[model samples]
Target: MKNARYLPLLLCLCWGGQAFADTPLDLSHPAAPTVHVEINNVKGKVTIIAWDRNEVHVGGLLGDGAAPLSIEGSENNLSIKVQAQGHNGWFNWSGDKAMSDTELNINVPRAASLKVNVVSAPLSVDGIDGGDIAVNSVSGRVRIDARTPMLEAVTVSGNVAFSGHAKQAKLQTVSGDILAPSLGQNADLQTVSGHIQASGGPWAQLNLSTVSGDVQLTGELAPSGTMSIDSMSGDVQLQFPASLSSSVHASTFSGDLRSDFGTPKQPEHGPGSTLDTVAGNGNGKISVETFSGDLRIRKQD
Candidate 1:
């Protein structure tokens, strides 16, 4: 799910100095409570996940202002909005630029949804352990750590990394590295110009594709259907399980096939044996495709 909000995010820069609140807000409003917060910092990160308890926990810095950061709770949803006291731009033409706001962090229930869009800051989502997450960042690094059924993440100028088991996932970036802990036999991943890596644990769905990056799969995954991965300007290396079978088809317009496994039965199909021949015939699956990159399948220990 993609959210397109054309709103200008909070900008913290030097303008008019506002009074400072000696203390930050520390309160426990658990269970479907929506709390909003504002973080002022030149560099910071956000970590959110699902928990067994029913409460909302938040703690972060305030961009120099006597006015207390506003946190409004409406039912199960919490919104944390920061109001930078000064109207000055994030930085002046001085020696070095500095952020005029404080860093913001919050801990909420995993089942709750989050809407976080930042300007010139790094954003991270961990232990998603709950429902779907909708996030976007302009120049900050974006990351999601959870085992949800579905996940969608996008970043314009930062690296994207995911380390966990997932049922289904979709991630992309203009120029960043993409990594996913392989799924049971049926998982998929795609990217534009970064390296793609996935580890398979069971028999599920697997697909990896990239335009100008390398694709790698390292882990034990079930074999019934085909696992597909492709790269435009890089090599594709896949390390399969000991007992699984895979049908891989790879070809590069200019690069030669550098396969370490059995050669494909046909020449038209570069090299690489089917699931049935490697360790044993696959459970009887479908297809896997990798292009513009070298394809290598190794067994995991």
Candidate 2:
């Protein structure tokens, strides 16, 4: 009878051992509606969602040998970092083969300001409203679905996709495509060897710069909006509504230029062409400059 009683204890110990192998995390902190949250991670997926509650919740699975998620700072300003265990310094796991990766799922207030930094890990943010958001990544795709006043995203060799509205946005990438279907008032997009495809807004000001990458923009312009595209050896295409009023000035050096509003004029002595004309009432301004790239300006049906 004594041996039978010990059997239950042995089973309990075995079950506890198995549970200890996988590290689970569930943490929360009280936060204000406009709280500032910063998350720094390396080499793992991070997903953030905005909720109506005024608190920050972080829950995820840590890989084997990974350190627990660290949350610090006050309620107004908080920072979350994931460090690899058995590392030489805090949050530094360079040259450590036994380091573990982390997959984080976080929830913050809907109006909180967020800044996320990652290296080679995909980052996703959704359902944010009325706060500044910035995401910086290297070689990891970034997807955002938010409506904020200001938004900025930068990536190196990773695609960026946004489906929302913002008052002002700045996006930069290298060798990765940028796709934004719904952008807002003012946008500045820059890329090197990466294509930019965007459609949105009656923008007040839009600036696009690229080197050896195509740029395609289709949207409405504010009454006095200004849109400019500068490219080097990449195609540029802009499509506007048929009733749009814009002044266009396009020039190309050794490139083909096609416009629906005006006729192209080539210099008689130089190997270049320029088009300077006004469409509709010419209330807006559109300028495109390219070198050895095809430029097309179309009127939307």
Best by lDDT: 2
Quote the positional error of residue 24 for candidate 1 in Å. Answer: 3.4
Give lDDT tens digits, candidate 2, residues 125-233: 9999988999998898999999999999999999999987988999999998999988899999999999999988799999999999998999988998999899999
Runs off by more than 4 Å, candidate 1 = 1-28, 33-44, 49-52, 64-68, 83-99, 182-186, 220-223, 264-279, 284-292
Would you list the C-alpha lDDT of every candidate in the order shown?
Answer: 0.56, 0.88
- Candidate 1 per-residue lDDT over residues 107-212, each given as its tens digit: 7766566666654567776665546555666567777776655566666667767766556666666677776664544555666777766665664656666787
- In order of appearance, the predictions have TM-scores of 0.70, 0.89
What lDDT score is found at residue 115 in candidate 2? 93
Model 1 CA lDDT for position 11: 25
Off by over 4 Å in 2: 1-22, 86-98
**Candidate 2: residue pairs that collide:** none
